[model samples]
Target: MGKAAIRIGTAMAALALAATGAPAVAGPQDAGGRAAPKTVAPLMGPRGVDALGHGRTLVTETGGTFSLVVERKHKPARVVPLGNLPTDFPPAISKGPHGTIYLLTGASGPPPEQRPSVLRGAAAPAPATTLFKWKRGWPAPKVVADISAYQKTDPDPWDQEGFPADSNPFGVLALDDGTVLVSDAAGNDLLRVWPKKGRIRTVARLMPRTVPVPAGLPDVPPPMGPLPPAGTPIVSEAVATSVTVGADGYWYVGELRGFPATPGTSQVWRIRPGSTNATCDPAHPRKGACKRYADGFTSITDLAAGPKGIYVLELSKKSWFAFEMGLPGAEEGGLFLVRDRGAMPRVRELAAGRLKNPGGVDVSDHVYVAGPLFGPGALLRLR
Candidate 1:
């Protein structure tokens, strides 16, 4: 059977297995929310026939340093310094085909500007580089992407309005074919760049500045009375905190809503190739787009797609939750696996212990999650 067919079949079987109450092959859970030890096949990297094989994991630290960890030992294999990264650098790293590592670094401190907006592009040289030559360690990555390329092709008001260009880039994914996708939370857009080909494109622009809320949804409290003066812009701050491209070539976006706000919400959006752009009101240039794939989650910080479905990593009041994606009908879709944190104990255990503020996730036969923490970020291996 074809790969897609096999994935579908496996998904159906997993669903049936759940319905039959068949015990999971391995239960990696114990009291106090820790994962119990169980013997399982070690994760392997992709081989000749397998498209999704487990392999070595690499993680980047906040200071632009990287550490490689082998799966079997789960110990640090090597540590290297990434050049051109700033002291305030916040790094996002991903492994391209054949173990080439791509690192994305954000601008250090806030620019000398005051605006309730996220950064869009990097003013300084983006701290991006490729390491690991294939013959020796991994293939050295080529400079195949630039965030500014989109500004040149399709200019948006955010570009002109001083939306922080080098906002935090929290996620990175390398396609098997060398296409690199980076999610800039500050810019609220998914950037696609082909360094090898010197091509740049904005695969999708999100939350155009005209998204509307329900009418009569009191802009202010009764005591406060009238809303802020007319012409006051309503900045959505719909930051794309994390992103992952599926084997089928669809891009999944996770929005971290309301940074620096009390009681923040989160959302998940799926954008397929050739999707249409929603109309933006010329009069209200700062409003966000009306068309959206899905919404309504509380602080979805990371996302991953596997044979089962899209897995969402949610942060609520410093707590974490896992949501499975489901396409309900023609009107976008909704999230499932709600409030069932135990269903994915691996994620739950990570959240409970090491994974604070997780920003990226990728799943194949085994799951790999990355996030920012003290002492060089962590790459958790879930098998």
Candidate 2:
């Protein structure tokens, strides 16, 4: 799978199985009614989350299920299973305008070789990566866009692969006018999909990121090859993972820098609404329709914008590569709020070292993060 397999929900099970001696804890829950954080729902491999008003939240799991989490002040939270997708890695979901809900599925394929053989050739009944739409009282979600078909016709221009036809729709943002924006982690581009017309188009292409190989890296073993010496400049894929509309109305997208997965190398880019063919290159950030918003993040898996600011979710504090390798100091994830502070963007850690492999985040009355990311996770309410 190499670069194509560096997706969020792909190798989680294998990585978990390999790290047998790692500690198993839910991390710390915060302290008061207004200042404490608590788990609102118990889920397995929770990957996507979005807030629905009146103490309701929509969460998706890597196991292909999605549910509505309802919380009451005096009672325990209730998780109501709504429906399940055909693909296992339904990584993203969002509540759009007028109570409409949009769900996105990641790349579909056989299970990783490390997993059980029974799961490898399991039959999939639908397209690999698709956009689905649903609303209250709907029996099931309706297919709104065929993302994989679109990629077949229009491949990634800057893909490092010999065959550029890869599409993993990881992030989704539903607009007020019924248009949705999707970030393809494998395609390395932002796409615009019109639900009403069943049309999809490339909105922008994320440029490659140059990450410096950090020192003291662990040695590789077996099927994985050896790495170069430290200080090598590795040109990594942008791995466009999440998208959101800012409070200021600009479109913000975040990246999970590929390969080597250097810590603090991931970035968030700001693009003008309705931009076409824009570039999100960190090198020439301010020169195009897409510009750098805030950076110095490690393995950003999701981005959610609210009145406060853009909430960024990092899968691991050290980096995704380190976490995949089960390195020390990589198990604890982080949540941050990025907002404009005078002339610069200020990133403040909301739950520093308090989350374990958190993958999804959203802001409603307060910030919410979904965790353990790989297996048996929960939806946490942060204050």
Candidate 3:
């Protein structure tokens, strides 16, 4: 599982702590004292957002409904429902050629036993990780790709749990050629899909990184029991969560490093155009088809690339675990911009200490962020 694991696990953790009457855990706190950015539209748990041009934007709620927000100069923005998606959690949306809309939903985590067993004449269910295509005047979107089906057949080579492949299709990028790129957070890979052919091919695989555990964690019971000693280095999944096309015509991906969720362990990777089966391992970073473009990010949930640079949105300013586990001050998230500058790249935080559990971001004429993620959220515009 990718984002779902975090969301669901957080809920369960909160419930357990409440039952046990435990005190709030201490964790990372927001550092910025600057004023928060202005809100563009009030939304309910908005998780995915994309700019639709002409002062319009598309946003998706955690409950599956889509919204279209229209902004006018010196006027309050208007919000309209764009209909609900079939999935409970729609993660990403992209505009395809000729007004086509591509949306992604679902993640790996349904128990194996939960798979409906086929009896006498019952048909099997559709794959959960799906890519949907829709256009105006259509009743609903049509399934263009079954991402989980491909994952089942071609499992993750670096799967930590062993057997039973995991596939959380989190990020999507639609190209002018009708081919779509998807980032699978659980599978730790990037896939290229041909909508017309209903075929999928692996573009790159992200290798797990070794992250040092942060200090000040408590030891608990079985299941999630005991924390490893602080500063202990452990291997973590490369939870690749986002994909965006850069101004240079190259593909950019951001990772949400898994378990222990060490802050500043995530990295943004760059993949060459037309690359296939590329490796994004830190061990052989430069030698592979995928190379590190930027590093030292924490729990990046979404990325947006523009002519100037790329916008990176973190789910939590602290590590995701700190936020998920409800550490005292881990409520605040962050937004950052990464820009190329000669031999060095500059990473700057924007509207610091303003965002809380921000999930998705995109740039058209302006930068748009969606957040608060678990509660009543909103779509905010950068100044």
Candidate 4:
């Protein structure tokens, strides 16, 4: 969920969670009395969308514009100019104070354009990792946080993916408590920017799972066909990606468990009051404090707290990688709900096979979701 944000009914929750592999949820007609339409008209490269303060929808796109799109058809869009700002496309959005919009961005660079490493071998040049606060009356949007300045990456790590400055702050939230929550997907941590306190806290740290080389053959064709390489650590990284402060008054962070996607490895964490960076440990996850709230999401893209509870937007393991690499699978995207809190918080699917690589979701009147994101991806109302 660059992302989204609930749950209840224990035995019932468990039963619904068990339906994870079932087809997407279907219901009666939508507003305007339409048959649960498959998808809204497609937009361009989408990074995130959130239900605005006015109950309208705000969508972030890469072509240097942040737009407010009314969910209904024939409504004209209002564009916010991002002049030399947000660096790249804002990867996520959240509601802010007094009609303000918080745009969370990835480390500056063009949103991953999927340039084949075989060609453009150099890692794309990184930019000023930052968060922007946008609203009317300001000469320009304010850079609320210089995200890279706050990141303290692994002093020493085995992965050769370069340095700590590679922080991609994906999801963002501006809480009523005067704190800002940002998820650093590349850095693998949830950060709290306390402006007045003059401190940035690593509230939750997500560890990268080491998927050891199978003692068998490889799944994809090794470029070096004759000499098969040794067990390659599938370390694309499923670090902390999305975050939201739930209606329950606690904060939640979601993961996009790196490559070789472990079925149930991706998770959502609950952060309680008074919990510090060191306390919310996956090593010793404590229930209602820093515990895993939900599991088994394919690739948790964004999180939204809305009418149907907390909805998990899966980027769909297959389709996401299809453009990133060339691996193919069902590649179907979906939306799931966090069934309950406490340990092993269950998640149940609500919509499936309709989304592609959804990056952001805004839960409001119609439960609007955007993307299977790539090339201005489409928006759809969950039926």
Candidate 5:
């Protein structure tokens, strides 16, 4: 919900699979991928999407807005606005029971102070970021979660790339029990927020602690040559970008491999339901704990569960932070499909070359995707 859904921060992360069934998982090239051959309309920084039965869909316009697009038989589609964000930045969205809509925004991304260089001529920052909830036909939303108080920090938290530490909540899901799960990419952890309870707590650590890029570069996406001089963290400790509930009743998580643009390093991890302090250990996973659900992907940004399978969207194999750190990457951005649910879930690439920098995804009457996010992106209907 967070990273890919809004991509408010500089990068995105994602991956998901059913824990139910499938044979050997195969890369798109090996699985006879489906070619994407349709364009619906232009979407500005679409970071997330959800579909309500009967042809109605919600697409997030990254910078603080959700376009409620409705299509009918032989009718032109309609788009409506649905957010009151503090700043003009990308945010995340999710649909709950009984026509309920949930919107989440955090106080992160390029702060107003850095706009002179980072944003150049972008909109000014809002006073703060918060979560809003609404039921169908409700003219006003109820402010449920206050992430602003969590934004109060000393000396400011900056990442290895020297960017302001962000509370940019990317992925967000509204559980049936009235609890909300949010992935704070800036915080590199998952948060369990009880809106009604007025409580919040850490759920899991998307990536283990940052590690030094040992000799030979072990798992930093091949052919990157040797490591470069320092300016940022070589290993992406953790950017808990997205989260979803697998059919197995487990919480699946995704993360972005830090700088150096490690292609295969970014992973979608599996976490136990109601699990707290989940340790997503990619190197040496512990049984009954968080481990790699799917690897060999690049910058996975979002995921959506469909009748057929789980849809995965990757922003880019290349790294934005790496490019900033003088370590450019060869990006292969696009959409992918994950089937089965057991440990060895199957995977297939659908349209990567065409769907550049996809931010989020969802399934309904058809599959919907948004890309080139970060700003002025486009939305496509891939059936």
Candidate 6:
């Protein structure tokens, strides 16, 4: 919370030439504002590879290595290297239903203590299995029936709140039957493992509880410099990043909250399944069930649901915010699509190339999207 408030949450939003559909010029627009006219949906991966269909795709390379994109139709089809992780580890890859591939690793460190480790690959490279582990503070889960033994221990014991070792296990999912969801933007929580029988759980814990800044909606800008002694905990107000699990099962959590230098404003929460504890005060006494469904978003990182519905990915300008899931708390829900902008024009067309620090995204039959590549460390894919 002090590196200039974590670089204004992650900084990277200052290029607005606007072009696509044209017609959004008020102020800060990037997370997908212009750039329309899109219809590239033939579906073809593995030619320089970026395919995330039913086959493979488990990229998470800040340098930690989790690369494995195999789908060769012509060129790019070889990156297999699923091992080394823990330098800036924020991997989240999921593709389960036969080919089975799940690699959820997030460890900015701290909490009960375990930190990050949950790798599993069913095909090529094979050897990468950790399952579960998290110590410093505890109580971080969103779904879990079992996860091999949860690495052995440190499930929560009775959290104390102090682990900020680095915290950054961004998102990971592999449902269909395998069941493994992990998202820990600094241990704000959301881990559920059940890889067979081992069992290990935390289910959900995105903090919440800060709500009160909604008078006119523009006041939080004052610390552009030195701040972080008051109470600390400013990892962009419980970071959270991205976590998807929706064909209807319900479990979409994406909170960037002032990232990459005030991208514009970020927020996205929707946890169904039972709803009660996201981390404290459901009525207190212990709390832990899960609640909070919708909220205005502006900086949401990545989240994709198939069937052609919920797809939210806003990396500070490269935009996307489509929704349509109502019935539980149904507040007149049913918007089919809000910012289609031509289905996805590389999120704002960013000079025609698009996607810079994208992150992670997964939509059933098509639409894949990855991140992490300032230069050589590739993982920049789009479907």
- Model 1 — which ten-residue stretch has the worst lDDT? 42-51
lDDT of 4 by residue, 1-383 (tens): 11111001011123223434332223344334545534554566566777764436677765435666644446544343332243445577776667776766565343345322331111122345667776655545566766777764432132225554456777888787767788887676778877554367777666555543322333454542332244555444546778876777777888876544444557777777546663334445564357766666656778888644688877764423232333344345667887564545566666544555566776776677776454535556665
Which candidate number would show the highest lDDT if scored against the true structure? Answer: 2
Best by TM-score: 2
Q: Which residue runs of candidate 2 sit more than 4 Å off their true CA positions? A: 1-7, 17-36, 108-124
How many Å off is the CA of 138 in candidate 1? 8.9
lDDT ranking, best first: 2, 3, 5, 4, 1, 6
Candidate 6, TM-score vs. the true structure? 0.28
Candidate 6 local distance difference test against the native: 0.41
lDDT of each: 0.42, 0.78, 0.76, 0.57, 0.58, 0.41
Which pairs clash in model 2? 31-36
Please identify model 6 stretches exceeding 4 Å from their true place.
1-170, 173-181, 184-189, 198-200, 209-298, 303-353, 356-383
Taking every candidate in turn, the Cα RMSD to the unseen true structure, in Å, is: 14.1, 3.6, 5.6, 9.5, 8.6, 18.9
lDDT of 3 at 193: 96
How many clashes (backbone N, Cα, C below 3 Å) per candidate?
22, 1, 0, 22, 20, 53
lDDT of 2: 0.78
What's the lDDT for residue 225 in model 4? Answer: 36
What lDDT does candidate 2 reach at residue 112? 43
Candidate 3 has an lDDT of: 0.76
In the range 134-231, model 1's lDDT, one tens digit per residue, is 11243222344555444445544343235444344455667678877766555666766675665656665555333222222224446434544443
Q: Give the CA lDDT, 0 to 100, for residue 252 in model 4.
A: 82
